[model samples]
Target chain A: MSLKMRLGLVFSGALFLVAVAAWIYQLKEGLILTNMQNSYSWGLYISGLAFFVGNAAGGLVLTSSIYLFGVKKLKPLAKLGALTAFANVTAAMLIVLPDIGKPIRLYNMLLHPNWMSPLVWDVIVLNLYAAAAAIYLYILMLPELTGRLGWLAIRVDDPHAFSERWAKRIAPVALLFAIGIHVVTAWIFSTQGARDWWFSPVMAPDFVSVAIAVGTTVVLLAAALAYGTGEKYQEAYRALGLIIFMATCVHLFLMANDLVIHSWYGNAETHRIMDIAWGDFGPAHLFEVAAPLLGAWLLMRPQILGSLPRLLASSALLIAGVFVHRFLIMPAAYNNIPMTMTPFGLPESHWSLPIASGRFLPGMGTFLDQYAYFPSLVEVAILIGIMAYAVFLVLLAIARLPILARENQ
Target chain B: MKMGMVIDLEKCIGCRSCMVACKQHNAQPPQTWWNRVFTPGSHRHLTPPALGVEFFLPVHCQHCENAPCEKVCPVGATYHAEDGAVLIDYERCIGCRYCMSACPYGVRQFNWEDPEKAHARSEYQEKYHYGYPEDHRHEGRLVYSPLRPKGIVEKCTFCAQYRDKGELPACVRGCPGKARFVGDLDDPDSDVSRLIKSRNAFTLLPEKGTKPTVFYLPPKAKEV
Candidate 1:
């Protein structure tokens, strides 16, 4: 390994260790250590779940679409996409362990699953997606594996042809999974009528669009990192950049559509949610919308896409923006209390329900009608740890696996 | 056999006895109240919402026929009893808190810390634990327990320990204003059913389509 790669592994390994320590502390103390109370029950960790699910789904979608669409120029980068999908899906699954109050009782989710729940569906889809991603990655790498191993001659008479045929068949299936994973994840939030902010039909489509945009960005980063910004890969990079821009446009339109509907309706619940999202969490929301747009704009530039540093930086902006987008999900929905019943047909008579925060500090308000929730230091540590784990896995796979084309070629 | 409650707002003094009775008998740790009462406008009790007339709204688990909480519980932890009461199995709850967001009334409370650690007794009340110091199971599910485990969600069981024993819920029994009534909503002759008929009772957030068993009589101030 290169000196930087060794240093990178050490850094991620250290962050992963810190996450373990924080998780242990969280388990012992209970969820109160996090800022989430009854009102803000879904916090940063849930956001992380959605975010990484988007990443995983997007990465796989990029890999599988290449085979289905026959993007021969993008073929070298397909392995990176599959590898990221595998690693990120694992990270998404691990992140849920810390968010749940009782990890010991996780088996209950499987043993006595409530089919009515969107959460149960998400659990099932996520697991299936992870398994499918692993198999797809292995098959996509089969030709490479068979070439390197003489023992593989017994199993397959023609490994290259077998891989080509199988990867093609699996591509459509993996693409369906990509759509299914994000749709199911978005449904977990949107199915609830309680939080009107999350109760829109548009959310599912928007999630898919965001997934493609973010996933393509992931592939682009992986490609540029694995292969220098040489003329050989320039055409493929241009094609990938176009995918990110178009998908981002779709995502933007969906967001604006939701915003117009909410603001136009102008109900108390709608007004309050918009106000909270824009007012208290304004900067995060700004970044959520701005970063990806800017990233896409930069990718649209012929000059920027030609340079490795500029390409990676653009991808970083997109990732950062989407991270904030996922984090923004909690505040707008949770802050707008769901109790909108009018008493005696008088809207003013409807009182704000101050939810018990499931926390008590001597001087603070114990019951909160609205809360501006921020993740505690412990939660932040764990979130970073999870990101590091994903990074470590991606770097390790790239280093160990036959991810890039053979150097002699 | 649909168990429910009806709170008469006109008779309610907003004394918050129901809140206290619920907290004590339910063995709620600090920062948890299965039932709470507040005026419409102010944090203070008895502050009128409009027309300078005082009335209190006591909100808790609605025991809805179409409970969002029950629908969203991934593990079948929150389920409806045969008697139409929404109950949670503490042992079954995975502490995901999805049900907390799904409930419109915001009555669900999670044990953020170990209940024993949070419910630290003061010197004046040495070694004395509050609530019906016994575990209460309904239909083979551990629905009500004094020492609840941390991380799981808990809410008003309508005092299941007392209800299962053929007694009124503590809130209904302890209300000084006699404002709270509990009985079978399914029975035409029951107090809750009659009150709904005679008082033009309504449930909170009816538009949510939850079909809550609990009802409330509009405050007389509206008529005035």
Candidate 2:
């Protein structure tokens, strides 16, 4: 086996082992292994869920380049990005399974769904988006499949097959569908009026912008990894950096806007959450603030980060920034000011403890473990396995199929 | 017919016995309850400290006729029974927590972990046992001792189990202040029915259109 294949197998196998170990520990001890408690039910799994969903947003951006704007240089990336969407949504779904108490009976969500709940709507949208994303990528690849497999698309191949014509013809519509998938995902969270943190007019756009930034970053990383034998994918890499740079600017603006809203509103919940972001939840803040700032600073002068090493480092930093951004948008939204607790400056005698009230506070440990959900080693292995498998699958499809036009010698 | 609860804000002593009784009867965990008491925000923050931090409102799932939670559930897991009680099917919930958002009153709670670990005292056990006819003791011990399962949403049921037995909810009987009044809206002769008729009762967050069944009678205006 080649070195790349060997590395892929080793990486996948190691992740598999760790995930399975975590799963077993969680199953035996229940949620006690994790720190998730009553006050904040959502932790790492939910955070990962949001991150993965956001991660899929770039596939749409890639689709737009090829189908919407007729940018042919991105044709090589369309199938690869679609495959990433599939891998990500799958990872998100599996992570959520262990997060809930009754992972065994998860089917009840579909069997007895609550129509009005945003969560239920989320379930519908996630599944639909996954299906649409998968099909959109596959349909675009049909022509490629027919050219290479011969037997895959149909038994016999005609050079000018009608199916080939249809595949190219409808590719634009599939691209549009891809854009809808992530936009609707943003709406699901934004519509919740109770949590002031999530109630933002720009949340949908923010979600789309960051998705493209991270997605393009991942594409660049993958391209560099593929060219390890010293080949240059310079054109695609340059385009990727430009896209990331622009998207990073949008992403930063959105973050500043959210803070501005919180300060301007000065409501109890909003201000309390702002305090948590700066004070107790400092690690996440560090990631969100530092990574992007450094990434942008390093990449700000394109000439310096133009080389492969600089590009990879910048991508890594940006990816970390996006991860912290995911955490900010998710778990932090659950902050509340318990009406039972006396306002901080109140007199001691006036401290009236209510007979019954729910108290909200910052939970301990990595937010993910609190729900008693530690992603099982099996889950992590599967996640790593799927990602490796996706990379492998995309590479094989691209190499063997006509996903990219044959280059002249 | 509208079945509801009337709480006299002035009479509440905030002893939290009602909260305890709710957990005891419902077998809920210590940190979790369908009913919670809220001491009114301190009026001391006002320009003058004349107003006192007077009343504590005990709240639960209002069993709203126009419940926001019911409309938002994608799976239709939360719904109202014919007798005007909001109900949940524990076995069916996916724990998505969308209902947690739809509820403006913030009553619904998601079970982040298995509830059994936190249920310290099993008061629900007593209600399930046999009790006397004349007194609440006639009812049997509360059979439901198990805490709520994880990955499902749970809230107050207005003691539906006790209602099925033609008895008052545990909190109604447990209130030492004698401030709670629960009755069938269909029965005009019931004391609660008369209280609703005589007193100017108001539902919290009525503007949200949940049409909450829990009514409040603000402290009677002080005599001039």
Candidate 3:
């Protein structure tokens, strides 16, 4: 194996070990280790799940868009997108397993499902999307694998012809599933009418547009980094960057629309959520909003967008922006429980009482009093492990599998 | 028949007896209260001068007819019983805490640690017990299960197990001010039903459309 691959394996392996340690600790101590409390029950784990699922959906959407548009130049990068999608979706599913309190009873979700629950819908659609993405990836690689590998060549007479026909048939269905997965995730939040922040009808569309932007940017950066900004791939990178810029603009527009509607005409509950987002969470919120706009500007500049280093930096910033966006949505809504009087009533005094009297514990507090949420050490470790695992899978695929399409083909 | 409660805010002195009774009976872990008393209004303190007409509001699960928490449970761990009481099946809970988030009243509490461990370390052990399978027994069954495991969401059941034995909920019976009343809401002649009719009772967060069974009679207007 190459030195880069060896180093990646070591790093991811360490992360995997750390994650296991964290999980064991969590199981022994229960969720008390985490900062989450009765007030903010769905914290970093749920937010991270949403972000990772978006990443996965974004990858599939980008690949499907390539086929739909008949972009011949981008065809070489399709395999990379498909592989990323499969790896990311798998990682997303794994990340959520640890968050479940009773993982042994998790099968009950499928066994005795509640059809009305958006969570069940999320499970059904995510599993279906993962399956479709895997098949799509396999179809993409079948011809190359059969032709190159000695064993496969002997068994298959015309793998190339069969793959082409099958891929053509499955592409549209895979695309549908990709869109469905994100919509289901968005619905999980939006369906909660009790939360004014998530009840907006624009949530699903916003999720889709942001996914496209982040997904396309990640693919662009990965391709540019792996295969230099040479003449062959430069056009493909530029096209992908343009798509990212467009999608980012749409995402920003949706955000602005939601903000204006909520802040201007919305009820007191909605305004309170806006206050938290623009007040205590101001720094993260500002970065989330500004980074994407700046990245779009960079992408618009021909010289900057063409340079591999600059494009990678811009994409990295854009991805961070999207992550912050996902993180802010849930907490802002949670901090806005209408009946909780702390945030609006007496600010400093009541906040200190719960903490001083030891009634609140370390992380526990009225939702109205505090909005600060620091992910516990266990949560951070688990998240790092999950990301590292995703990186490990992608690296292994790139090294062992026929991921890159041939130049002549 | 639908069972419900009517809390007289006018009579409540914020003594926290109901909270104590609930903890003792349910064997809840430290810092977990199925019932909580809040001094509503803009008053910084609970003093008589600071409080004008507003009184202490003790909040618990409303057990709504259109319960948001029941609708959002992915595993059907939380459900509405035939008797109109919102119930949780702990064995089926995946501990996703979706019901906690869905609850507008913030009545739901998740066991962050083992209830037994919490009880053992608690300073108030003399007042409340917290092992699995409570000391009290009914028909040879433990009044409260001892195995109150961590990582599951819990809330006030309105003492359904006690109600089954033709006894009042611990909170209602323990109230010194007789501020809390429980009866069959479906029965027109029930004391709770009569109280709601005569006293202009109100439910919390009517805009939420939860249709809460827990009614509240606002404190009587203070004389000048």
Give per-candidate clash totals: 0, 57, 4
Provide TM-scores for the models. 0.96, 0.80, 0.91
Candidate rank order under TM-score: 1, 3, 2
Candidate 2 Cα outliers beyond 4 Å, as residue runs: A24-29, A139-153, A159-170, A228-232, A278-283, A286-290, A293-306, A338-409, B38-52, B101-106, B109-147, B184-211, B220-224
Tens digits of per-residue lDDT for model 3 on B1-224?
Answer: 99889999889888889988887777666777778776654334364423244457788889999998998899887877777888887777888888877887878888777766665655555545442244443333332454565777778888866776788998999899999999889999999999999999988878889999999987766554
- Kindly provide the TM-score of model 3 when superposed on the true structure, using C-alpha atoms: 0.91
| Per-model DockQ | 0.67, 0.29, 0.48
User: In candidate 2, what are the lDDT values of residues A319-396, reduced to their tens digit?
Assistant: 889887777765545544222233222343323222222222234221111122334444445344434544555455
lDDT of 1 by residue, A1-409 (tens): 8877788889998999999999999899888788788788989899999888888855565665576666787777777788888888889889999988898999998799999999898888888878878777777767777545545333677868887788788787777777888999999899899898899999999999898888788778877776878888888888888889998999989998998898888877888878977788888888888999999989878788889889889999998999999998888898888975555445565457788877665456768877767899999999999999998998888776677778712
lDDT of 3 by residue, A339-368 (tens): 544322233322211111112464444323
Model 1, C-alpha of B220: deviation from truth (Å): 0.7
lDDT of each: 0.84, 0.61, 0.76
Q: Candidate 2: deviation at residue B55, Å?
A: 2.9
DockQ of 1: 0.67
lDDT for residue A319 in candidate 1, whole number 0-100: 89
Residue pairs in collision within model 3: B132-B146, B132-B147, B133-B145, B133-B146
Lowest lDDT 10-residue stretch of candidate 1 chain A = A146-155
Q: Is candidate 1 or candidate 2 better by lDDT?
A: 1
